[model samples]
Target chain A: MKRLTLALMVLMLSACVSVEYVTPYDPVIDNGIREYKESINTLAKNLGDQAGTEAGTYEANLAHYNALESKIDLLIERANLQSAGRGCRLAEGISAQLAKVAPEPMIQTEEGDSYGCTERLLVLVKDQLDLLQNIHQSADKCNAMASPRGTKISCLRATTSKAAMKITNQSINAVWVVETAKKNGDNG
Target chain B: MSVNFEQVLANILDSAASAFGDGWDSIKTYAPAEFKKISSQIVEIAENVAKYQLNDNEGYSAQTGKLLLQMQRNATEGVLVAVSTLTLIAVQNAINAIFASLRETFNDALGAIL
Candidate 1:
């Protein structure tokens, strides 16, 4: 009886018993997902200023990216709900998409809208970001499935090179609008 | 999804009562009503959110969203304020119960001695 009592005491103290409904916060996953959403939005907003031309495409891209960011937030919330279990698949997809875009440097265009350039540069950035988000989302899923933290870190790193390649491959155009925005102080 | 949140709430109180060990049961009764109020508030906010979904870029609807967001913030800030304060009363009640139990056990021992 003493041993059983002592064992029960330990279980309750640790909160490790088979208690039907206990929600434990997993800080790493929670904070990391939030950080991903914030950074992706920052990246999207920053993308507009860096566009090759002042066409509608840049603004459209910004809207698309914002939508994506919102979706990521929802996915992360779902993941949190199942933090101790299998976790949400949507969370994994978003992370994967983010990893792809992390290293891809913003590409500028030499010709502005005056040169008849449609300026699809922002779209490229969005696609790249989406790729990274996908990978990161998958990583979140893997982490949820009894994954050790050590393995999860390694998984995030595995996609680093793909991101680096796209970013490094870019030939930055002199017509980068982001610098101009900063100079002129056009936040909106 | 009318999950009898009350039952879930009741269970929590039951476990809490067991932990308290005394006249705490009397005081513990107060918690269900408190939880019920919280549940109602949460439901109201949820209903309000559903009634007027906030815009994406705009966050919440400026008119409705702002009110709801402020309400949400206030609720978040205020949620534990009541529960935690009441918890002290619970602890006091629990202490009183344990003391009473201890007194009875000791009285039984004294009676045997007599």
Candidate 2:
């Protein structure tokens, strides 16, 4: 058991740098995992404490959606953004795409873990992931987001380039898994 | 009084030594009573896990946080006992002491009920 845990840890350490969603190596994009779990807990707590209705639900749902939007601030810490020129572009793209999403009702949940809340939260997660997928695809085509830190110029000229797309893909996949953890936790 | 609870606690401490890590040996000298008490708690919680799981998963779940919370709530008393003479390495050592103590308490309470 310890060996498996150690092996998993090693694999995750390496894969975390690589950027795959289901790598079994990475532990859900370090910061991303922590933030996502917090958001889920917050959303669930709100739902449980609040009344049942669209307005009540939206107020709770907005809390999570707002968190997703704020994640763009993470890019500021990445040195690659300054030289790549794609940083601003990537940020704008993410903003524009995510803007369309609103909390909606989840039909049925197959998430890996417990539903932990009403269908309302599930739909919100799924919708944001759908938008994130699009943003990732758009970014991947440019390849601008991929440069290692401290680089003056990178392979991709645009901020939302293909490399940035990869991060988007990873973010989406991570969010999707948590969103559907009830499905993955049980059925997957 | 009866000696069953202390023995129950000792058995659990043996089990808890695994989770408490190597530092426990040194930790024991400072607050032998508290250490023994905490070890017993670990055993108690494990015992409860079996009983509670068999009866009601939710009930078992509720106790999970309570064990730790109760320890924190009574930190002044139990902590004094646990750290009677030990030189602490870090704040986490105290947390570890509490965790060990709580787990024992949980196990004991659960075991009696079961």
Task: Give the candidate number with the greatest DockQ.
Answer: 1
* Candidate 2 wrongly placed segments (more than 4 Å): A1-29, A48-55, A60-64, A72-188, B1-114
Q: Considering every candidate listed, which one attains the maximal TM-score?
A: 1
Indicate the residue-level lDDT of A85 in model 1.
28
Tens-digit per-residue lDDT, A52-131, candidate 2: 23322333255455665455334222212222322111112212322322132122123321112211222233333334
Model 1, span A124-187: residue lDDT tens: 3233455434333232111212334323211222122222222311201111222222223222
Worst 10 residues of 2 chain B by lDDT: B80-89
